[model samples]
Target chain A: MLRQLISANMNSLLRHFLILTAMLVSSGLFAQSGGEDFMRSMGKMYVVVAVIVAIFIGIVLFLIFLDKRLTKLENQIKENGKAR
Target chain B: MVKHWWKILGVALLIFAFTAGLLTPIRPGINDIQPTAVVAGQTVSLTLTGYNTDFNQEQAPKVILWKDGDHIINALGVSVLNSRQVQATFQLPTAFPLDEINELKVSTSDPANGFITALPRLRISGMEKGGEAAASAWTGTIENTDSKGGFTFPYLPNIYESVRNTFYHVALWFAMFTLFTLGVIASIRYLLTRNVMFEQRAVSYTSVGILFGILGLITGAIWAQYTWNKAWSWDIKQTMTAIVLLIYGAYFVLRISFEDSDQKARISAVYNIFAFASIIPLLYVIPRITESLHPGGQGNPAFSRGDLDNNVRMIFYPAIIGWILLGLWMAQLNFRMMKIKERLLENEY
Candidate 1:
């Protein structure tokens, strides 16, 4: 039973890794393909890009917090409601 | 009192400011002219480009030329090239008291629709004249100062369309200052009461404030490019601001370097206070006293009342409020998350 559960966890982790990698690769591809010229065409309005970045950063930070919360909850359940 | 009412309000204000700030139209003003210098008794075709002004050649809008507030050389009639550009043929008074500098202004007849109030003084540099002064068209005439116009940003000579950057650049600075103040307050509270929650809050505020400061710098550089003709003008104010940002960066470094929770809180809080204190002189005070390209510089266009007109101020003030509220909301979320992490770590130990 312990071996089977470990295999299942590893599979899920691998799947998550693949998905995140795909997302990063696709975004990098999009940026590499004419994103620079596209942004420059708009009167060098790079300020808009900066604003978008700040928003995405806030969202990413929040997601990180949520991820931590989920990990903590999962650990608690595994420990049968005990911290250590 | 962790109420979310203000957070919602802040978001709403930001939405309005963003939409209204972009949507608001600027009034008509001269953007350019050809042949900056002029000799007496010459027919010059002056081409003028306006921001959002409509010009009708049939209306015969007059281009008033003032020579150092004493002489007048009124152009004959405005020939409208399009809504944005127009031309006028000016017959220089053969002999007016010659001066080294002269100014040319243009406006339409509609009093309700005011024209560029001030500051875009198209200088007409005078050349050495050989002949005598002829009976000129620019005789004694009443210069119109009061023109009723729709709301518009002040048309500056160099800062043409980039005036829109005001919402992003100026408001971000305001927001950064507000967030930093809150951070300093939270740090003091932590030092006084030894509350871990306050320390977390202080960290969040400082982080968000630093984010704003970074945004301010980026947007300011963008504006400086078009107006000052350089990305980094080496202005004292901008250099000081960069230094202040680095100092705040050190505050975060101090926070993470200390592994002990209590020591991190105590030391980082002190550093945060010092960082905030330094911003006053570096960002605001020294910039005003020194010769910089910023608004407060000596003999700068900022001394004029044309920086933020009533229309811009309407949207700008709200933008400040929105950005600050958003920063506060982010800081609050960050604190909550860090607090949870702190609890989990404590449980582990």
Candidate 2:
């Protein structure tokens, strides 16, 4: 049941992530003009975007590491229970 | 639901902070002025570039060159080049009222965009030796223009809109500090009671705190890259923070090296206490004492009235609280997982 709930959460998280990426890409294309770099063009607003992305990725990776550790512990418990 | 109210509040505060931080408009400011230096006795045309300014408004901007509180020279003529640019002609007096003052402040005030001053002082050359009579050459009063009444972020020259990063980058450090404080408390408790539960809590909190410190460094580096033109300049604050992280990194290495669980917990608990003690001097005291590029160096307070006005404080305080609560929540999860693993090992025995 816990596994089911986690998968459901992951599915929604994936959907939201894809939507955010699509919006950013579309906005970047529209905001581009002349010879200036796309991110640098809009008053360097993309610097803020870059900072937010770095933070989000850091938190997500930390979560993934925690999830992997939990998975290993869960496997150890399952093996112990079957042996008994 | 009552037990989880703080969690809900954390998420809500973060959503509000993120939205408000991004959506607010920045107040108008003069970004640059061309022909930084002017001859004392000549008519010179100077071009002013502005950020978030509307120069083409119906009410034209009033430009002034100010030497001191009592002396100011109004622009002889002003022409709008575009919304963000203006050309103003100023007739300089043969001598400044104050002979020692070589730099003049340039300011522009318009009703639509409010008042903004150029960051760089204008240099004046070829001025004759002056007496009290030179004060007569200065005419006109600096106009008192009301700021456009609304909530807006203050404009900083190099920082510009990225001043919004104050919410994320600075708040991350605040959150990290809170976590490390909690970790040290747990470490002290473990030493007193010899309880493994407190040890687990300490480990969880320190791990999450380190994660946050890393995030803070990455975000700060990104901000510095554009504003300071370098991602890593070995700034004093940067060097101090790196040392703090390395000190805590050794805590984890020490934890893994000990084969006995009890010895591991007791020894790491003592090390954690020392690590926490080092933070105050490394992050706070040394940075202020040293000549540093980061704000708050050389005995100046980091969050002065100028650096964090009421407008920024609104979102900034909430961001700190939200990040702290979220970090605590992560630590709680890690602690629970550790407890479960311990239980599974006991059952195997």
Candidate 3:
């Protein structure tokens, strides 16, 4: 049963990869965009956008980690106090 | 308190770095050319694409082609396609020496947009030894670019705007080194005093250091994909850093394998010190001796012949301070939470 589930996940992953590959080929992405093209688009603000987005996601992840810890700490304190 | 002041400083510095890093524009640069190599004396059409260039502004966007260090020629029939793309037809003098120029220096200048100075080696091939440059070949003079600059990062051709990754990629390593150093120091203090609190701080700082190191690797891979045209080049520096991370990773794994808390703390602390000691040679010395694509390694200019000028240094230095302080703040928070969990577990027993 576990092996079947694992195979299903692999099959779905491969399907998504194939679809993305097909889209990339059809769109002429390789022919069109060089390395600098993405950064240069929209008056060169996209590099800034990429950077700000990366930092934003990093900070958000840290916040989530903090939040999870705080919640766990609060729960532990409450349960102990109630037992007392 | 005194501690609170530094935390405020960290936040303030980051805000400054963000504004300065993002707001500052890259100076003009030519990124690449199609038909990079050309047959001499043949009429070759070349497309030149660049960043922050204003070819449209020029009346006749001209290109100077240089053979030797001193010799220069004007490419024939230059036309501006757009702001970024310029096409030039070069009618090469049939007898120009192939050995004389492996690459022809291609320079385009606009009065308003400034110059991409020091462009050389655009790859001219297949020409015999020539007489002096024909009078027609010397169509225009190679003049210097005018600077209309306030503050800007030096425009690196291949790097382009991604030069801004200096803040995230390079500074993350700086922060990781700072945090890891603090971790090793705390671990040493724990060894001397047998204080569990010192051990806690050591573990907390190392954990946060690991997080930043991972983030550095990710940012590097992203930058490399755009700049070096690969996600992972397996460059010497990359391999060494991965190995360093793996050694520290083993420290964490070893901690989990210990049943006794004291054993976990002491042994991991020792391993942490060993990890720190090995990393200096791994990150610093070894990569210097070997070839590496990394900016500072193997005597490649500390990011291209010191192209990092005052404009970038202003934001870059502060960004390092902010990230290190921010990493420390996270470590402190984690340490306190660990204490909370520790006390609660004691109550359960």
Candidate 4:
């Protein structure tokens, strides 16, 4: 029963992907008709900026987490020295 | 020493690429204006102006007037009239009824290649009100068009050039955000471990972040003036940016407010986290919902792939990379300098 349910869900996901692909192709053709290419270019530019920001933020978050861990270890070392 | 050498090389390469990118004779595509409407059976004249690069004369522009993509009038071999001016005149079709649609394109072929540069514009405006009738009839070669079409793509270069300032302004904010995030993390660690080094790092990052935040605000203010007709408008984006600066500004005040070092660090760290929380709503959330004249304002067209053309992308992408790398270099120096300063203070006392 579980296997059957998983198969059904995968089928639905695949169908959705195909529909999205179709929509994208149709819109691209529509944009080409006007020859303006403004909207399409704007989307790409937005994604580029978004990606840059996301990566920068992700790296910073990771470094912050690392700093926290390192500080914890250093404190443990100090406590050990006091006990010794 | 090796790391220092690599850093120096990185800075030098960034400078070289940036300079080369700026100096390259790329066409900053100008803006073209379209006429909103026109009346039938009335005579109208169309006027157009050309904006060229550093070497305008080299490109002999050919202005073509079209009705629904069909060529109506063509002017070619246009030369520089006096210094930087290229004049052309065209008469609107009297036969087309009111609300007739038409387009005007100004093109210049590359002297190097046969490929033409066509900056297509719309010309759908109506005839002017009671004018000197005689002034309308004369459609001669080498004459200017009287029909008041809106400013062409020529006005766009100034706007596009302003985007370069984004590198400096946005870079400062990016660096500031990075540093402040570090400060907040260190503060949190200090709470858990009660380590002084963690506290020191937190203080250093906050200080550096504030410095960058101030620089970002200054550059953004100057840029806003030329682009928006005012240095500081009460626009949501501008206002929010100012608020972010203020929040960080208060971080300093909160630090100095308390004399005890431990108390200052603890309070300031809490404030740093709070300031960062506000950053999300102010810079990201608020700007999207509020009305703004800035590009990508609420309900306004945001910058995306569709908006940035090859002409824009040629300069914009390299600019982002160059600016980010430069920011990293500066942050590294700031972080190192901060360490030395703290060490000096420790020894002196």
**Best candidate, TM-score:** 2
Instruction: For residues B234-284, write the lDDT of model 2, one tens digit per residue.
Output: 998898998999899889868766768899999999999999999999998
Candidate 3 - CAPRI tier? incorrect
Q: What is the descending TM-score order?
A: 2, 3, 1, 4
DockQ of each: 0.11, 0.28, 0.13, 0.01
Q: Which whole-number lDDT from 0 to 100 does residue B163 have in model 2?
A: 85
Query: What's the ranking of the predictions by DockQ, best on top?
Result: 2, 3, 1, 4
Residue lDDT tens for model 3, B1-349: 7859888998888888778877788787777787778887788887888777777845656676765445667777888899888888877765653344456677776665665543435777765655555434544576755654778887765666667778877787899999999999999999999998899999899988976776676666656655677758998878888899889878876776676889889999999999999998888788878877778766642354676778888889999999998898988988997787777767852
Docking quality category of candidate 1 according to DockQ thresholds:
incorrect
Worst 10 residues of 3 chain B by lDDT: B130-139
**Regions of candidate 3 where Cα sits further than 4 Å from its true position:** A1-55, B1-3, B32-48, B57-62, B67-70, B74-81, B85-102, B117-120, B125-143, B300-304, B342-349
- Candidate 1 residue lDDT tens string, B16-90: 977777665555665556655666557777776555566665654556566434445566766778766767777
What CA RMSD would you report for each candidate?
Answer: 7.0, 6.2, 7.1, 18.6
Weakest 10 consecutive residues, lDDT, candidate 1 chain B? Answer: B110-119
* lDDT, candidate 1, A7-60, per-residue tens: 545644553464344334433343466664443333334434444344444346
Give the residue spans of candidate 4 off by over 4 A: A1-84, B26-47, B53-60, B67-83, B89-99, B102-122, B125-160, B299-349
Off by over 4 Å in 2: A1-41, B98-100, B300-305
> Per-residue lDDT for A1-71 in model 3, tens only?
45744654564455335433433332234325655565555444454455445555555555666676678
TM-scores for all predictions: 0.76, 0.87, 0.77, 0.59
Q: How good is the docking of model 3, as DockQ?
A: 0.13
- Candidate 1 global CA lDDT score: 0.66
- Give model 1's clash tally: 6
